[model samples]
Target chain A: MSKAGPPKSHPLFVRITHWINALAMILMIGSGWRIYNASPLFDFTFPREITLGGWLGGALQWHFAAMWLLVINGLVYLIYGLVTGHLRASLLPLSPRTVWADTVAALRLKLDHTTGRYNAVQKLLYLGVLALGVLVVLSGLAVWKPVQLWWLAALMGGYEGARLVHFFCMSGIVAFVIVHLALVFLVPATFLPMITGRAPAPKTNEANE
Target chain B: MKRDKSLIAATLKDIAPDLKRIERRLFLRQSLSLGALTMLSGCDLGSGNAVQGALDAMSKWNDGVQAALFSQTRLAKTYAPSDITPNFPFNAFYTEAEAPVINGKTYKLQLSGKITDKKPWSIADLRTLPQESQITRLICVEGWSAIGHWGGVPLHVFLDRIGADKTAKYVGFKCADKYYSSIDMPTALHPQTILALDYADEPLPTPLGYPLRIRIPTKLGFKNPKFITEIFVTNDYPGGYWEDQGYNWFSGS
Candidate 1:
């Protein structure tokens, strides 16, 4: 809103954490696909071409390794977002009516997008994906050490059930990513701000103000 | 337009050194992301020795984490007799037809390493020791799991009877099938660790380790060596067949 300052679309910390999160997600999901292929719950398996590890052993190594990065980096992101009020400023104040209206606008290809500010639809997707991320990690721990974390495993409906829950959470994240990437491609100018942390002020001062 | 272009070029030149430093950092990050992308695309770019080495190191670190989290008092879940998997599947590097068939009459459980007693005990001698039984799930690293009833002598009791050096770091096993594995002393001393001799209240079938096996409920299925011919206590790490092939050595389930 201040014309005197640079139009910052993202903070430096947010940019760093976002890219790191992207890397971790790719590693976790790719290796997870390979792990699933080892003993698929469904009849069909994930295609080898889309998997990370060359084999089950290799995949397990990658999955275990990337987990630390994901969890630690995720914690940093959450703490920074909450303590600095970045989370509230960027993504908050959503109602069912706003979401429905936004959804209708999106369907009609008429929704307006502003740099640094998430729309109602984006808010819901981001929050939903964040919740799914937490669940997937808990379910993973339950699967990894069912004996040590018996209570967690039980909460997820035991070892086998935990695996199913983990799988569904992963699916949800992948879906969000697909939609997110598509939106970014549609609004190509949104991509540069994430990298450089700033965007040129829009021609209309009223929108930014 | 020409003046603006020259002005931008002058700014870039002025910060060339800083740009170079930023580029170097970007290179590292980009390589990592690129490696991950290639791995997902099923390219061999991620198979380089550097990536493999990093992954191996991380796996070992995870091993340490899991060991620390393992509690002596925390026991694996036990199931009722009816909960046992019907027709428990036989699993091994070798097929069921190729599984070693040990003769109970001629079998001698050999002991070596740091143990004070190097004497060999026959199958009958093992039977004479106090026996225990439990129904526990055997989770495999491959993601499948099965529950089976196992009966045997507690490994710690056997170690005590054999005068095993409790201070030793590892308890290693040599199987008749040429398979080998080792476990940390803490895991070896876990209450659920047993030298199993029976399955489903009957003598072990040939395909299921015949005369002897280690039924460690705390570890993944591969850690439970079958057709064990020798047991040794030592400070040396005795890696398993699967473990040597990249499976984590301390694959605690």
Candidate 2:
């Protein structure tokens, strides 16, 4: 990589959207846990007994409200990505030749080395996260309107099934976030673009040199 | 008690300053900090008759207001049986321990309420009343739901037989397995809701609600008391076990 703080990666709009989406997801998870604690699908709950103003209903209301925001914001972001050339450079996999080369390079380094902005692994993770988000939204609708969205409910096998999907989807997102944070600390340069809207743009002739 | 628009507006304006003062002093300024502290310490923000009474009264008023004003907006719509899930799981207070006698045949159905008509109901006695059946989904607050056909005697029919008085605003349902829950009588009497005695065109399975269970369509699955034994009519909303731990009492669809 060039130095530490040189400019290159994210647009200002993209950076703002990314942070907004991240904050919204965190709120969604926290509030969602409180909603879950009402009956507790598994055996987890938000720390309501310890927190001030820990209203479970309020949590659910916030969750549902944030859900709408996440959906709308995510959709807008996706549309922007598609309309712009960001999708190709940022989201999709790199060249086929680069995939295996990067795979070996990344494995040899044991995921410690950085190869370009987003490696194959990051691309794969982004794809999975985006797909899971869609699943969460659909499953959420199945519960929100069991009667109205009977077709979606039926597709998920029914309301309980839809709930199961929603729960698992949430679990996946949480898992992804945990690993993501770990990777962020693991590769500080990776997170620089997110915070500062830029990465160290590699020297064009440095590799040849 | 004069219900005139302008007069009500004038009265509200006259009391607005006093209401504002009390709100600013008690609720807005002092109580907010107190409320935050109480929440931090895991305590109810306000207490006693003045505060609790206000809360309880407001809860009741809200229920009434929702019932009256939102009559046009149905909370949810009923659906076809095709929408039912193939595998619906049974939850909480799953089975009946001792079979109770119903009617005069020594068959016993027990009543476990603090009300006057404290007697065990026989299966036959419960069956004697008019029965209604409907296929509805039991939506759980934990984000799950199950659609199944529920058959039960109208609680109002039983409540009438037991002579539930005007003072009885809430009904407590105690099951054979020690599971107990209370519901507002208005919800109890809702034409669509029922104290289900059967499931899927047969007597309730032991794993499900055996003798009887409450099938409240408008509420969450947890609110439906299974293996019901005792029924009590009280003035206060005693809340279900889960509800006591900070759950939505109404749990509307």
Candidate 3:
């Protein structure tokens, strides 16, 4: 890769919140699976170890405890991302026309983030994950307090409907994680920017810096 | 995994590695939640950790908020007769095979606490008090739901007839199945909260809270006590079987 200098991709706050959000989501999903096990929608059960707290009682504690973290960190990310114009400037211009092209390009292993901006597919997925995070929180509130947030619960097709929506959002998030990880693995260079807050050191930039 | 309430104060503190680090830092930013809950609800700092106290206290805060928001006039959604699930599942701490089959022939409901009348009433007396029915979904916290027909005397009517102190803080039920529960005074008096005597217009089946039960449609199924043997009104906090075990006490569906 050729570049003038090694540009910073993620800032410290973004990096910290990203990791925190990731950890929180993982804990929430794991414990959420344990909770789902109590009265499963399906027949088979997810293994217990995958869950955070190990059992139903423990799982609930983790679910709720992590929920606070997810909500707080996510809010910071959202407000800072929006206010700083980072999310909009970096991930937008998600033209429907270009999205398909970007998807094709991504499939061909040509999608790159050397410029510190997300491609259409990346933009869509990042935006989607963000939206799903909000949905998870909102739907979670409905489930957590149906009467207090009765309107939200009713809007979500009632209590049971909120659970369904919550599960689907979880699935969406898990899918995003899978794709996100796979993309990072394929373009290993895409990984460091998140962890180190600096883009992969291009050959010329390594010397220049 | 499946222990009793004695573990709540402990479990709430045995923080997962990630949660511990995060909770410590987040506490500074979220102390407002702590402040609001404490100031608004007067949460009792029972023998528990900061997080446990916070979780329990927050749940209490949630109860106050929900109670403030609850409307006695509002009704749970009703369903058509055909919509009543034919195989309305029986769920309890015990399996269906182990559901208690009370001797309805000799069983009498014991009433106590802040009521003028402490007299015990037979199941027959209960059946004759007032008959009403509604078909509604029994939402469970664990992610499944079932629609069933519950028929009973409105709890408020029964409480009124029994000369219950309407301003009491709580109405507790002692179940024959050893599963006791209580509701807030407002919830106890909710129009839809009934002392259920029948299901599907038939005498309440053994599998479905045999002798009598509290059918509170506005609440989760567990909040509706089953196989009730006694009813009492009081200012004391009467925690439910599951409530003592850490489930939110005022869990309104």
| Highest DockQ model number | 1
Output the number of the TM-score-best candidate: 1
Candidate 1 structure quality by residue, lDDT tens digits, B89-198:
98875446557778899999999998988899998999999999999999999898899999999999999998999998999999998899999999999999999999
| Residues B1-253 of candidate 3: C-alpha lDDT, one tens digit per residue | 3223324533433334234345334432332332322332355533225545556665676677668878888777788988888788888765465577899999999999999988999988887787789988887866678889999899999998999999999999999878999999988888888888889888888989988998988888889878899999999999988787567677785
lDDT (0-100) at residue B158 of candidate 2?
74
At residue B98, candidate 3 shows an lDDT of 54
- Which sequence of candidate numbers ranks them by DockQ, best first? 1, 3, 2
Q: Write the per-residue lDDT of candidate 2 for residues A102-195, one digit (tens) a residue.
A: 6787778644333345777677777789899889989987776564456787799777788789889999998999998987676555666677
Model 1 segments beyond 4 Å from truth?
Answer: A1-3, A200-209, B1-34, B37-47
Off by over 4 Å in 2: A1-7, A34-59, A93-98, A110-116, A201-209, B1-131, B134-137, B143-149, B152-219, B222-253
DockQ-superior candidate, 2 or 3: 3
List the DockQ of the predictions in order.
0.27, 0.07, 0.13
lDDT per residue as tens, model 3, A1-209: 23577577777889999998887787688778878987786677777545544445445655776787899999999899899988888887789988999889877866655637677887888889989989989998887766547789999998778888888899899999998888667566767778888876676333432
Model 3 chain A, poorest ten-residue lDDT window?
A: A49-58
lDDT of 2 by residue, B1-253 (tens): 2225334555554454354345323322332432433332245544322443333344445445434432212334465878767766755421122333232345365554544586777888788889988888778765656778888887777777777763567888776566677777667776666778788778877656776788877666777887676677777667876555434465554
Error of 1 at A205 (Å): 14
**Chain B, model 2, TM-score against the native?**
0.65
lDDT rank, highest first?
A: 1, 3, 2
Worst 10 residues of 2 chain B by lDDT: B93-102
